[model samples]
Target: MESPRVEMISNSFVKPKFISKEAKKPVYLSPWDLAMMSTHYIQKGLLYALPKNQDFSITAFLDDLKDSLSATLTHFHPLAARLSTVKQQNPPSFSVFIDPNNSPGARFIHSSVNLTVADILTPTDVPLVVQSFFDHHKAISHEGHELSLLSVQVTELVDGIFIGCSVNHMVADGSSFWHFFNSWSEVFRSNTISRPPVIKRWVPPGSDPIITLPFTREDQFIERPSPSCLRVRNFHFSSDSLVKLKAKANSECNTTKISTLQSLTALVWRCMTRARRLLPDQETSCRMAADNRKRLSPPLPETYFGTSLHSVKATATTGQLLDQSVGWAAWRLHQAVVNHDDKVIREFVNSWLKRPFVYTMSRYFDASCVHIGGSPRFDMYGNKFRLGKGLAVLSGYANKFDGKVTVYPGREGGGSIDLEICMLSKNMEAFESDMEFMSVVNEEDNKLRIF
Candidate 1:
């Protein structure tokens, strides 16, 4: 299929409306922050439906977004600054920081596409053109020096608009990403940020606060992974379906119950493994990101602005995952999430300080490994730029490879969730055909249509 064309309307930078005295100082990139140096930008799109009223002006709406975006950047100073790395003596270390004084601000692009809202939402799978809506879709976080760390593209559709944001992963994690998004929307509608971001960086005790990266360039850091023929599609899990799965998992397990997320994760993991047709003894694993904000001793503020993430993997043989009940798989996932506390986080940090090991996403350890990014916990539908209260459809671009699944809160809310799963064409076909998997997922919620 031919890719859709994206016509350039206009492109410009959106500088902060107000600069703080602190904006002059460089913000250090914590060891945790630099850990994401090799990953791709977090690209997401919030599709909004246009009201039938003729009074709404696209020109004024675009200006409003830029105005609010500019205001939002004042509180999120790092997004306005460039990531700068200092060259040091041979073979020792290098430091990175946000060059605050030279703020050029976030990149904003006003573009138009020949597609309607239905052209995107009605498809069974996300269109290739959707990738073009986001800037830096193929660029890594480490490349923020020459580019804007935050890029927003306002794409005009025949009957809708897509607010696509590409955020540098090295600068912030999923929590911070959504924090900035909600804050931006908050500023748009009300011109104020209710909860200000805590921009202070944190480091492990008895360790150098100024953590230097092990390498200078990305190639020196790690080799890039080759692009794969991956098919990304969404599977919506309704509240009712999730209740059944959770109840089933709970009935099969102990006094404690598994979370809705864990139950959903187990279903995807097991189904994907079966779809892959791996050997019974072949090892399969699921790696999930654990937020360490509340786990720390003097816990970082809930609004901490940098990456505070650690990967927790649950591994098992294909036979173990398949032969066992769905509850069994969920229990394994629950155990992994529960066990990743502050102690484990600290140990991981100390080990990194001793010898930095950037968990390269390119490395696929098990026979089949799945990495779950984003979280259902985020207020996906709450990002109301006042265009509407609910999302017509929410999706993302970039960093997608085989076995990558991003979890988003469903528009219906009330515990419903959406999983954007990526897999190779054949595997996805098998997965789609899987009776066990499809039988549980709500048929009505599976399509990428307007909520």
Candidate 2:
């Protein structure tokens, strides 16, 4: 299939409308923050269907969005800051901090595409469709000197507009990114801001001094993953199919009731492993990102704008995953989540403080591992953007790294899920034809017509 053509209209830098007096001061990065410094930027986007008869100037819309984004940064100051290290004489160690003065502000681009909303609504090459709407180079750039932690691109189409946002993973996680996004949209809609984030960094209890790991300057920036022939595809399961999956998963284990996420993760892990046809004794694992906000003692603030995530892994031999029932695999996944209590969260923090630079679960990037991203409960569809016509669809984009799967709420508004699966091209072909996989999924739900 031929790729759609997109024409760039303008590229410019957007600074904060109002800079805080404390903007020059440094903000410390927690242990959790350090872990994500080398990860790829988190990219999110939305398609808004404009009223057919309602004529509006695209230039006006772009100006309003840029102004509103600048206003939003006044509250999210760290996002408008550059990452740097602080050398302390007393400890003889350097700590990472966000330097506001050095930040040049977020990148903003205006572009136009010939593709209409209808062209992208179906199950086409999603990554290719969404890639043109985003600033792909800046999204994955590892050059720290750029100092632009956030970038936004507004692509105008004949029938609608696509708002694509990219944020440095080191500065924020999914929760934090959405928090900023919602706030910006609120500003754009009502000309007022919502709840400002709790900027105070959450530190682990106890007076033990922070051990600064020895990391070179290059380690501070993320190294782009090696290129590969990976393809990304989208699959949707209806609410009814999810219910049947849950029932099947629950019947395997009398003690635990598996949630939709666990069941789906188990199913996908099994299918991917089968499609890859790993050796019988090869070790396979599924890694998931768990939110530690409510699980922690006293709980972090709901608006804490930083990385409050922990990586949880469930491992089983390839043979076990392939031979076992979906329910059994789900039980294993459930156990992994249940074990990540307050103690585990604390232990993870402690471990990171000791050896802050070493990547956690780096082995999971191998072919035998599947990394689960996004959550069913994130309310992704709720982002209305106050555009009057409502949001047509919401999507996420990431580097097409193998073994990566992202889950989002189905557009049908029922208790369903949309899986964005990425793997080697050959593996994707095999996965598409897997009968067990096809039987569980609602094939009719594959095509989505948002209009």
Candidate 3:
């Protein structure tokens, strides 16, 4: 049970090759960015299989990756800069910009572990050793100025190489995080980046560019140790299951046909509520971050960098949610998602500016509330790293708590989806035993159960 241990071989910072004048100025944090200040740093990792025919040199590979990262940072300079507090203004403001003189280059770490790729992937649940692959595990996004905004770790496994990244949640969401990951892989494979990042921060016009929080101390945002025993498992919903679920939901709803994502969200939310054994009149809710790239009046580019999203939620009584058909639950969620338009987005941001509301872990700890994160649309397996086989696996880590859910694109690359769900250990057991939930996510085969 205690055989694998991670050995730190090296830890260093890799600075940008060059920084443009644009990056020297304060890259202000919008309301969306400030909203994530209290959350844990984003943890993402990618593993690639080592080819059988070649004898790889770990030293040579590390040198090559550092070189590529240096060039990558030249364009993604905000990631190389500090989290700044501008007290010179009437109301103190927070921004991230490269002082050039005081820049702490993005962290680069190299480590080795005595486990094979199979050892990490063969289990139904993530192995404890897997969390060690990432950096800044216990840190929060508020410490961005004090620490590396972006940290990467390369772990040498017995039969593969794992690249783990820790990005400040205040700096990027799931979309922007993958954008940087994709660009890095491109730079590593070829000396060119196809989609250069648009590093300029986005603040809705008329909205204040600079945001000051209600609290100033680091203790306010740091994650506290939880006594709850949480368990995480990724349930792969095959493309076929999605089709059937969507069809069933559409047939039940007369208003609008529910999307694949909505159908899946409904099923999960309903099942989770049922498993929690909430009271008939108990309040239950679920939220997902809506992408504003295309929803804004002057739409943003999908390639736009930084956080551009708003949290919208659906609420219902436990009785209402469970008594209704799956299609009814899906429509409730769909309405929340579709009704959140440009007006809704701007209004929510402005309201937050007036109040400076920050999310606390306690809010998601509610047994009746579920916070959905990430999207299946993200290209998880696209990090080829010059190998034709692409990535063996990629997963999120470090920020798990009760009721936190993340969705990922299935490795098979079809319409398939995977939900990385976490809950209190006892609740997780009950969730897995729910027959209705298992119908859409049956563990009848290893291909669906194991990655």
Question: Best candidate, lDDT-wise?
Answer: 1
**Which pairs clash in the backbone of model 1?**
none
TM-score of 2: 0.91
lDDT, candidate 1, 1-451, per-residue tens: 6756988799999888988888778888777888777778889878888767789998998899999999999999899889987877777668878787665789999998888887887788888898888898688877888889999998988888889899988788989999999999999999999989998788876767677766655566764555577887888778899888888887889635699888888988999999999999988999888899998877999999999998789999999999998899999999999899888888888888887756566554333998888888887678888788645545556777788888888778888888888898889999988887898877776663543
lDDT of 2 by residue, 274-383 (tens): 99989989999998888888889989988998888887999999988888899999999999999999988988787767766634234337778888988766656666
C-alpha lDDT of all candidate models, in order: 0.83, 0.76, 0.80
Q: Which stretches of candidate 1 lie over 4 Å from their true place?
A: 1-3, 364-367
Task: State every prediction's TM-score relative to the real structure.
Answer: 0.96, 0.91, 0.93
Which one wins on TM-score? 1
How well does candidate 1 score on lDDT at residue 391? 53
Q: Which lDDT value does model 2 have at 96? A: 66
lDDT for 34 in candidate 2 is: 68
Q: Which has the better TM-score: candidate 2, or candidate 3?
A: 3
**Positional deviation of residue 150's Cα in model 3 after best superposition, in angstroms:** 0.6
Model 3 per-residue lDDT tens digits across residues 287-353: 8778988888888888888888777799999999999999998998899988988888778777877
